[model samples]
Target: MDIQTLAARVDEIWAGEEAADARELVKQALDLLNSGAIRVAERVGGEWTVNEWVKKAVLLHFRYSDNREMTAGPIEWFDKVALKTNWREAKVRSVPTAIARYGSFIEEGAVLMPCYINIGARVGAGTMIDTWSTVGSCAQVGKNCHISGGVGIGGVLEPLQASPVIIEDDVFFGARGEAAEGVIIEEGAVLAMGCYVAGSTKIYSVPEGRELPPGRIPARSVCVPGALASRDGSHQTYAIIIKKYRDERTDARTALTSILREGI
Candidate 1:
């Protein structure tokens, strides 16, 4: 059956008894997402569009799946979702302790270092998800990026129509930084350590004190942590755009070091 028909069924029969047809449709939809034939969100005409129907299918699948026990060598897991496999065939370097659930896409040359990638997420080519990090459901991480240790790329399944986070190509998310709630890190941006950016988090430029749109950073921006005052004059944390540069071809490691050394 077509995805449209499946979506309609999900709308009618959701949260009720499990129907075989509904489960079948959900499985097919998940398979499409797993195969990278479809995505939960994508940039079209320079705008990010949320595919609500796809999200509904993912949610419905959870209802259909019951908790079960799974074993991997000496390790055992109790969960509703199945872990992703066949990394050798897919050309992905999923290290030990990396847990990627079914229905996520990890492209070729990507290396996952003890990370957790939830359903509907996509990790692009040559990207690295460092130790203990998470790529949340439906989040789209772009190519050749370095998501450093303990970083979180947020996911969204509730408010089913909401768009997930989008990290563009070549972004360097520093260690332990957290980004969530549909935040978009534009191409080639560098986020310094412990930065927290979300839809409500203020992002401002230093010296100029200009406020930028929340949840979206411009390309090539180097961001660090800072403090800003609320209406009551209480100091609160915000992301500071310390610098924005134009050299896209610069060495990422050297460029990041320069930004750190100059603190510019």
Candidate 2:
């Protein structure tokens, strides 16, 4: 069936008080999966791409709106079918209410840490996802990474063409950092504490004497706090820079000052 039709059927099944045939629904959902008509749910910058059927199913299962409620049979049917069919990696902890759809990969030795991970989110091996960190739809993440507390990796599934957040290997995100608007954080880059990087934000290289305008950051560059000349020409709003840490300044006082300078 077409996406619209499938969506309508899903709505009908979810909205009604009666239960659906578990075997039949699973069979149809599997058919859509095999045909590539349905996909995992993911969002980027306020947009998401999802199978209409899955969307309706999720809404129905969650009792999402006041307009609808799911019958016990369908809910149980979905639980059994999803358990049997969904591909998920072995993890230490996961929310019983959370769902993993599509063919997204989550490798072993990685900890999910009880948060929602949408479809099309490729999580690398040995990655630790802390509390309240969202890996938005289609956000690709690399291996052995630490997504610290409250980090948001954006997804782009809507508009049918926008890119998602691509994070390369061995990166660290400080608390509450927002990387959205198809931003690409290259391998080995470290985002400092409380950095909110959006698509339109300017990224400057103080050490290289260059500027990156929107949706990009240079690879392997250490991003630390810096300053920009204010609009009123009075003071400067501190900014962040991806700079190289020189080893020549090994002296304790100089190192402390250098560290302190970046924070201010």
Which structure among the candidates has the greatest TM-score?
1
TM-score of each: 0.87, 0.57
Candidate 1 residues 17-98, lDDT tens each? 4575777778888898898878888889988887777787788889878899999799888988888899888888788999
lDDT by residue (tens digit), candidate 2, 1-264:
666666666667765635446335545654454333454444446343444455345334334223233334457332222221232324423435434444344655555655556555667766666677888765767776677778888766453335667777667776788788777777667777676677766667877786666566556566765666766999876556766632243222122122211211
| Clash count in backbone of candidate 1 | 0
**Regions of candidate 2 where Cα sits further than 4 Å from its true position:** 1-103, 158-161, 225-227, 230-239, 245-264
Pairs clashing in candidate 2?
42-137, 43-137, 44-155, 226-239
Query: Considering every candidate listed, which one attains the maximal lDDT?
Result: 1
